[model samples]
Target chain A: MIAIERNLVTPRWQRVALPIVSLVMASIIAGIVLAVSGHDPIGTYQQIYAASFTADGALTATFIYATPLLFTGLGVAIAFRMHVWNIGGEGQLYMGAVGASGVGLLCGGWPLPILIVMMALGGALAGLAWALIPGLLRAYLRTNEILVSLMLNYVAGLFMYYLIYDSTSFWRDLTSSSALVFPQGKNLLPSSDWPGILLGSFTLPFGFVLGAVLAVLLLALFRFTRFGFEMRVMGDSPAAANYAGMRTRRTIVAVMALSGALAGLAGASQIGDFGHVLDPRGLEQAGYGYTGIVVAALAMYNPLAVVIVSILIGALTNAGFALQGPTFPIGLVGTMEGIILFSVLGGEFLGRYRIRFGRAPARAPGLDDEPGAEVAP
Target chain B: MNADLIVSIAVSAIAYGTPLVLAGLGELLAERSGVLNLGVEGMMLMGAVTAFFVSQTLGGPGLAVLVAAIIAAALAGAALALIHAFLSITVRVNQIVSGLALTIFAGTIGLSSYAGQVWGVGGQHGVHQLVKLDVLGLSDVPVVGPILLNQDAFVYFSWVLVALVTFYLFRTRFGLYLRAVGESPRSADAMGINVTRYRYVHTIIGGAFAGLGGAYFTLAIAPIWTDGLTAGDGWIAIALVIFAFWRPDLLVVGAYLFGALSSLGFTLQTHGVQLPSEFFSSLPYIMTVVVLAAASTTLARRRIGTPAALGVPYVREES
Candidate 1:
């Protein structure tokens, strides 16, 4: 009964304070680092905040940049909640890009509606296929998903490189002057683009709605569904779940595939709406996929929390441009992002476990005997 | 297609594999000690850039290469690993998180690029190239003699070094202690072994080897410095350790195989092969993925064997 009650304690304060404390701490440390580096830290901070928020066109740019991160973050969150560590989001993203680009290039003269559906399906299928390899390996072979997924990122990267640079038949554009053989893909018609519902100046695209709806639906599924209950049980302790007769392997594959599809949607949506051409550099920034992991960790794998975390991340990215100057290269943005992520995560522990001071503790002989209890003080 | 191509391929493999062997062995040692140092790439790049400048300033490729590689890569890797060691062993930080952070710190485009510019002109232009180390009297033999006997000093040094490492790991008392720390630091600690000291020393030694591998690249293979020049070789070195099944002896074969695949791109290009350059370029990643996937299977992993506490941070008291 005591164990059950302890397990039932929902982490509420941690769910709220982690991000806020982390952000504040990051800003403070960033200020100190900037000052020591001889830059005017005050001006830099102001510029970043203004450019990301108050500046004209900043919000739109932020949304455009963040759309992929939103989808990938949720993708990561979905798999993470099911106890599947899917680090192959990068690979899945690339596969999705390949799929969507293939469809886009092939159906140039097709109707808008048909092209949209085809591109979406192609992207999702490609992502699903890419993810399935490791999923099966982890589920059946009991291989480490972390290593498999991480390695697959490289494979997917290579595949992208091969399509662009080697196989000319599928992705090559001989007509282009550049040395790189551009994968020929059908360009998206404006009609096929994800329409943005504007409010005053903000143009929130259909992707936003899809992301929000998915987040809510996932939260609901985790909260109410029997499958979700089983998944949660599996995540908490796979051995226990297995002993209880849950089909852990099949569930792992299902969750991972779902994760891959979500990431694929990110790639498709980005290309369909914002990307002008299909090329390697069009990968936005390898930020979306990895950031999804950070997001998952930050939100503690809660689907509902991912929404708020995504927005905060999106805003910071949007705001990062203002900090750029001739003297300080834009790479500072990446460094700052890393600092922010690490600091927040480091700070998150405070919210979860309370640390008390004034110790005069001596270990008892049976200290090792107790699994959760500390040595008596 | 002919005999010369085959000879060249074999020679290129040796040249390419030397650095990988050096790096892979270092990672093997670290992982064996139960600390996965993923910052191998950053350390190598740092070593490559620093070695270029040091060699250029000091003249004489032999001593300059040694000094530059040791000071830059070994020292740099050690310093980075110190951070990792502190976080993992002391603060109980997650190994993956610490590793990723270290990589980001060292791998930032700004840091590496700036270091390259400040160092000097690299990429086939800046420093004196290493002279080939010919084995005495054996150079005059037939095809096999020329191919095998005549090579750079680092190639022979790498082979000798790997052999020594294998011996030290399997045949020495200290080696047993190191292995024990890796398997279970708590058990090692309770048995009167200094786990922290062993982990630190071995981890630093591992860093030094990785650094030497990075230096080999600047001094030999590319013979120049470029930002992010080590590319993903450091990461590959980590993967190779896994592929080699944590045995120092197998590292020689695995590294050379990877090295051959890496150099195959340029070799094929030299012969004007019709294959796409991208396919050739991405061979390392593809091979790494295939190898890791194959090795990761439960049946295969049992056959290959992994360090018991691989990737887990050791907390003596917590146990």
Candidate 2:
């Protein structure tokens, strides 16, 4: 019989190797599933790689996809590092888009640099405001942020849906000729659109640069700042932090707001750089906010690693679009992601414990015999 | 409101709330066993897709097909739950992370969607559905007839389940063991109770219940397969558990109240009320947040009866 035992101290090598082993195991499981479903697993994976990396314009497209995920992942990582689960990234993103659109649509004639800065601020503020409610509730009222944030996602989606669905709403595209068509908001003003940076033959949106910069900034913050130290201590043990006279409540709110701001920036970038519009349908389909959770998890809540993980996830998502067919459907990518996450979570055990195939170790005479031990047959 | 409108609303509320009741009860059971399974949404989705696929492909009598779909959904949900059980129970991973991973894996765009696409069940209206049944010709009795006596088999089954679950939790020996496991696993282990077995059984059963609820969406509510058809209903069910103070009796009331809130938009529209549809659509989610906030107060949580060891993974130490 196989017996699993817990190790008091796991080696550093085992900790690093487990995640990689889990990823490989996840891929194999995905391959088996694909094969069982009558598709060539190797061909499917090759197609994913080829389309994501080798195909023309694929890298640029991947960057575009990665941009939003990068911001959201960073947001999630920051909050998670402080032991806060801000599941409201999607909601905050929508609010940020709303804020950015408000500025973009109303002040179209503004100068390029000023407009971009204002839009970024607007988006960040909106996200911060959205996150504030749960943050406050969590800090003061002792509410669970996870449930509150999650519930807010649905509320935010409906809020956006109402804005576009209602004809009289300012966000709606009233000038469109056909009222019978599916309701969609107007695009951002041409002046509000983000310019791309030239890289050889490809034009990468400025959002990518912004995301990368933010990642570096966050890494610096975590490493060198007093606030970051406070966050880390508070996250490790709130009671202990309080005992040490740290302002835990303030840190909680600050961490959550910062997280929300990043997510909001992602939302703003999505509209300003890629979609160039505030369409609810497009926003709903993007799901960068949810995908951010996976990115943060895969990166182990490290702000620096989120950049790399986001790009990989972005590539997978981009490849998913290209792989959609009778045999290799869009959902296959989701399945693979789900498998990978499960494997990683399961692998956490192996990193901490060891499995043995032998009889149970003999129990110490006095310790093994409890007062009520005779009750068992 | 007029008698006819009231009756109609009541009927619709029952239909809408049936799934919540099923899922909420399942979560209640799992939490009672000290296993906080956050994968209800994922389990529900898997169940929805599995049931839809089974009903679509198996050509047979409607009743048989419905039963088959329910079974298939339960199996699917159990499979997902098994992964969660393995991770949280055996692997000793953080329960929240495990549950979150499972949900992502089984959510609308994940395993459920993959299965739906592979089975070619997406976009197809259900061929077999759980039709409303009138008991003892009592459906003709106005007011109460359509509201009570004329619900589908799923609703009736859910009612019976509530009773059984309530009894099992408070009256039965296994129920006592399960509760003991949730309250204090260490003590339960000392008492010769298998804490792991209790948690696993309850969590898997909880998953099965969530799957049954998912099947209710396709088989009774819409009779069609759509991506994310449940639309966060599973989350609402989780909130309902907290609102009910983890009691089966209160769960029914909370579920029905949420059900009424969900169906309010359609009911008002049908009656020519000029309220914004979004208001009604967002009410359930908004209320879930409110209820969770209200229930999560330190005093309330203690008084309202959350499982003592809930969400904490138990690891037995060698003596």
Candidate 3:
């Protein structure tokens, strides 16, 4: 019988090759599923490719989609580096939109640059506030942040819905003929609109540039800063960090806050650049917050790599929208995403272990006798 | 409140809570075996779609179709759980990541939706569904009658399952072995217990339970195939396991309580209680967070029934 054995040291080539191999495997599996469902996988993939890469204005559309993912991915990456599971990116992003909308409405008449800066600060602060509860709980009470953050997502969603759905709420769009028809907030003033760079016939939002700049800043912080080193050390081993004089609690809270701020900025960008209004439907449609988790994971929690992964995911999402039809459903993208993630996770096992087609390694015979026997301490 | 209204509310609560109870019990079993399967949501979705599809296509004697649906759902759930078991238990990947991946893969817009579309089952009602039945001559009795005796077969089945699980976990030798494996796999292994075998069995059994719960959604609750039919109920079930302190008895009570919270909006509105629906809608989630925070104290986690080796892959070598 074949026996799987853990490797003493994984090679560098294996580390790089496994992810790509997993992606290819995932695609093959997905293709088989599509083919079984009576759809042409090759044709579907070509359509996705054509819509995302070759179609007119598709590149610009992808950039728009990538903008929020970039910010959220960075947010997730930073928190993950500190071993904090901040699954509340969706909630934080929504709250950020709320904060940005509050600022945008009040300061709509202000100068363009000042209004933009105010909106960003408002969004960041709102996200920070939202994440603070779980962060503090995790730090002080040793609460599981994963569940807390996830639960908060539902709360944030409802809170946003309540605000926009209320007829008397200031954020509600009074311009609509019937408030009951669509529950959406007012559009931002012309001055608060995000300026875009003209490319051919398409305009790319300034948020993309902002995301690129923040990614570089994050990389620098992780590589050269004392705080980054402490966070990394704390993540690797909390006890060792504590013994070495690191303030673990403070680091946890600070890292979560920073992560929330980035997510909040993503939300603000969604409003200022694309939606231009606080619409619940728009927020749900732009699943950057949830997709950001996948992007972050695909990047292996590296802020720099998040940029490239976000764009790739952004393109896939655009393709999903483009390919929406009776036979070719939008859910194909979600399925592909799930398949890719599972494959990558499984691939990690292959990277760390090797399979030997032979009998088990000889050792002291016992119920657990097998290859890769551990040396007794 | 009038006795009749209270009884009716309680009845609805039981109906709503049945799925949660089933899913929670399954999750508790998995957690007890030191396997944290976050894929409950995805597995439930798969089960739901499978049951719906089977019931739709078969269109036969109501009882037979229901049985078939339940069996198909359990199989679907178990199949997904096997993937989780392999990744977390054998391959030794991060349990959380594996679970999350499974859920995303089989979630509302993933494999479930794909299946629904492929089978032409989307936006259709179940051909057969579980109906509420009054046990013996208890229909005319007071509050207890409707709340306890008048429920779908699944509700009664859940009660039995809970009782069985409670007994198995506390009173049986195998159950003791399973708990030992979860608490300290190394010691269990040293004692000649197959830790891996126990974990695999319990986890798959848990997945089967989750599948039954998912089938309840299409077979009883809504009786229709909708994308995201469970609507975060799986997540709530996961929380319910922790909230109940890993006890099957408490899990039933907690499930019913959250069930009441979930259906509170409809009940209140029907009784002419004027309040924003959002308040009631968010109640279950709010309570989940509160319960998590309350149980999060390090002392509580230790003193409470959380499995000691929960979320940790039990590699014999590492042990």
Off by over 4 Å in 2: A1-18, A178-182, A354-377, B298-301
Where does model 2 sit among the CAPRI classes? medium
DockQ for candidate 3, please give it.
Answer: 0.51
TM-score quality measure for candidate 2: 0.94
Residue-level lDDT tens digits of model 2 in A194-292: 888988867688887898899999988988999988898787677778999999788899999999999999989988898777878778877888888
- The candidate, 1 or 2, that scores higher on lDDT is 2
List where candidate 1 sits over 4 angstroms from the true fold.
Answer: A1-11, A28-38, A80-83, A105-118, A170-186, A284-287, A315-326, A348-353, A357-377, B49-62, B108-125, B137-148, B223-227, B297-304, B317-319
Clashing pairs in 2: none
**Candidate 3 docking band:** medium
Write candidate 1's Cα lDDT for A1-377 as tens digits: 11111112337776677677777887887677677666788887777766666789777767775677778888888887766878788778888888887787777657876877787787788888888887988888776676677667767776776666556556556565554443443345455565677879988866767777889998888889988888888877777789999998889998888889888877777666666345555473444676676666566678877877776667666665444445344445545565665665465434434534455345477734443222100
Scoring each candidate complex against the real one, what DockQ results?
0.33, 0.52, 0.51
Candidate 3 regions with alpha-carbon error over 4 angstroms: A1-15, A178-180, A354-377, B298-302
In candidate 3, which residue pairs get closer than 3 Å at backbone N, Cα or C atoms, i.e. clash?
none
TM-score: the better of candidates 1 and 2:
2
Q: Against the true structure, what is each candidate's TM-score?
A: 0.86, 0.94, 0.94
Whichever of 1 and 2 has more DockQ, that candidate is 2
